[model samples]
Target: MENILHSPINNNTLSDFISAKDYTVSGNEFSIKIDEQTGLLITTPRPKAEDLGKYYESDDYISHTDGNKSLFEKIYNWIRNYSLKKKLALVESKHPKGALLDIGCGTGAFLSVCKQAGWKVKGVEPGAKASALAKEKVQESIYPSLFDAELNGQKFDVITMWHVLEHMPDLNATIERLKELLTPTGVLIIAVPNYNSYDALHYGKYWAAYDVPRHLYHFSQQSVKQLFGNHEFELKETKPMIFDSFYVSLLSEQNKCGRKKWFSAFLMGLESNIKAQQTGEYSSLIYILNRK
Candidate 1:
């Protein structure tokens, strides 16, 4: 198990070092590469958190309620509206009804929804407080670490990593382990920010989705597909979560220069939505993949 890095282009930056086609690190059956174009790290076999501090930033984590009341209300309404559509789509899809696992199930909001839908739900989360909150909300056991969690040999019919993959230290290994945990014909759903989206083009590094350090890997559709294809997974479907671009852009603008730029944030969000609707390149995309 050697971690090998590969990139089509090379430079002196760490991003370049990781992305160099010849660069590879070996330890636990994983390799990480940096994409020079996007400045994102890609890994074969996901990385593990030796200590919580490396990944967890208290200030960055948003509560269920945080931003302005209007913005909060709008976001909640959007989430609620989209959740129904997403849940319906999931139910109608080929996904099985057996056990489901949600990796990095933040606050367990999605799990709670799934539970109400009558699916057997379980999760893995790293944040202690968020994990506790998820437990309270879903009343299901949540492992604090994906590396240490016991799967109990129960294969899952559906595994979701909503907005979680970019945060993974070793992306490939995580997906590999997930493949092992999935039942035959099982589906893995992943949602991540799309660096190729129009918002990214306009915002550059200011793009809200690149919640840097926390978002170690900013993936484009091509990169994500390539990552999964190299492994044994086949992409079943790819679609953008259009609204996220607007919301995330707002947050990103607020974080820029250490103060909230309300007008600029709103304008960027508006522009993101317009472009997302016109083109399918939303700020984020949700991919449904099946094991090949």
Candidate 2:
């Protein structure tokens, strides 16, 4: 484990933020710290990259798992289905249909949608079951890791990481590599949860988005801009993933009481979104960037 004293995005001192629990797998508590410079939150004594896989070995980790018997899982699937088209539209609105790369493209659902719209797509998913399922959706090869995805010097016009950036262990190296893989005029879209959001502050340590340990980094708007901007990626736009607030709050409600509370979660989600409209700080934000 690396007991980091400085923020990866900026070499600034870190201060204690809160102690969060791993409600998904273990009840073990983990401490979180914030980058005094960029406001990014990080889990100290972070699990090594090799050992991180074990944390995700659960049926509840929706993105990697296939099980959907539970009602929450069913809602997750429906939201995913509806969001696929919205994702496609967001990509098309950014740039003309060209080569696209979706890191952590679980099950290749978004890629399949892009392919159906006449755009070439490729995916990278490290999970065994999810990668295998992804292969069924898109005929194109699904690489196990971004490092292993050799493209014969090909570059993508658009690259997306939906709710995926926080899990990456090699944050700085990943951004450098993303730059290498993009075309000169390509667009990069990344979506991550905001610790500055209303729900996050309200739930404090119990915020479900802070799925401690597994989510290695917690990004604030300043952190996102500073980290990527340091690598010369210009911020293009910021959009909200409104539905995420509801979903995350639902899980958070369960985390607090160990049982589902749909109504209260919905109210919290709505209140969070409403408050976000005034603050421009959505629970989850999609940041689009380009080389500068």
Candidate 3:
């Protein structure tokens, strides 16, 4: 099955140039094609794998993977202070209290923050090592896969997908399922890399956010809103999560041309910060959405 959809443009600034193409995998529907012009995924209900290896245990953290108490402490502190702050802000703004779910909750960083803030938290993660680490760090029950987890008929006030939505092959179905799991006034928080950001334009295919086959879909702000709109969700607010630009750009610059460009990476990091403050279209974005 195939569907061709209009490309998503940035607030009608540029002509639509991207096209979206949907495909299927093992009887599950998913999108695999993205038009560079409009930056939209054509398919709606696509199939995706639930494999955990695709996201957990990066090469950078392999050395500190185990028995590195000091290293883990440092990492925990950094994430707790920074990443968790942004995530909490989103949750506090919308839900304030009640149960919360974090899909693809790597390392349970955000969950720790939520727990500290007194919100009941649960998560679904596929990565074994990461899930184990998360279990140790947060002490909360985490399901290995969202599809396999039984919610015990419990509903949540908020569902978060930080940088996890793009990895999904069945974007539409996933959204629908999340809707069913939500309370009538529940909110869903989604954060993903924005392909239409200035950094993406500057870096082109070298953009780090385009993590190849792993990032099944590249979404722009407009495209994401449209996706949610079709699924009976309302776009409550959108904000650029600027920190990822520097982090992703650093990785991209280091891996540029198969060589680590430390200096170039530093420059990219600086550039990302400047662009984020000025334009509010950083390399990544957080979307706060509510069911209609």
Best by lDDT: 2
The order by descending TM-score is: 2, 1, 3
Query: Backbone clashes per model, in order?
Result: 15, 0, 13
Ordered by lDDT, highest first, the candidates read 2, 3, 1
Tens digit of lDDT per residue, candidate 1, span 167-232?
776666787788878897888888898766776777655555655444556687777777787688
Write model 2 residue lDDT over 1-292, tens digit each, in one string: 7787888886888999899999987778988999887889999877788988988888887777755898888889999889989999999999999999999998888999999999999999999899999888788988888888475477999999998999998799999989999999999999999999999988888899999888999999999999999999999899999998999899899999888799999999999999999998889999999999
Off by over 4 Å in 2: none
Mark the regions of model 3 whose C-alpha exceeds 4 Å error after superposition: 1-32, 35-38, 41-80, 276-278
Q: 1-292 in candidate 3: lDDT tens per residue?
A: 2233433322222223332221111212233455454456433222235442433335453212433355534544564468678678768877769899999887787888898889999988777777888788789888877676487476899999988888776677788788888999998889998876776767765666666445667787778878788788999888877666666666566445565565676677678768778777778888989888
Least well predicted 10-residue stretch by lDDT in candidate 1: 19-28
How many angstroms is residue 268 displaced in model 3 relative to the true structure, after the best TM-score fit? 2.3
Model 1, residue 125: distance off in Å is 0.7
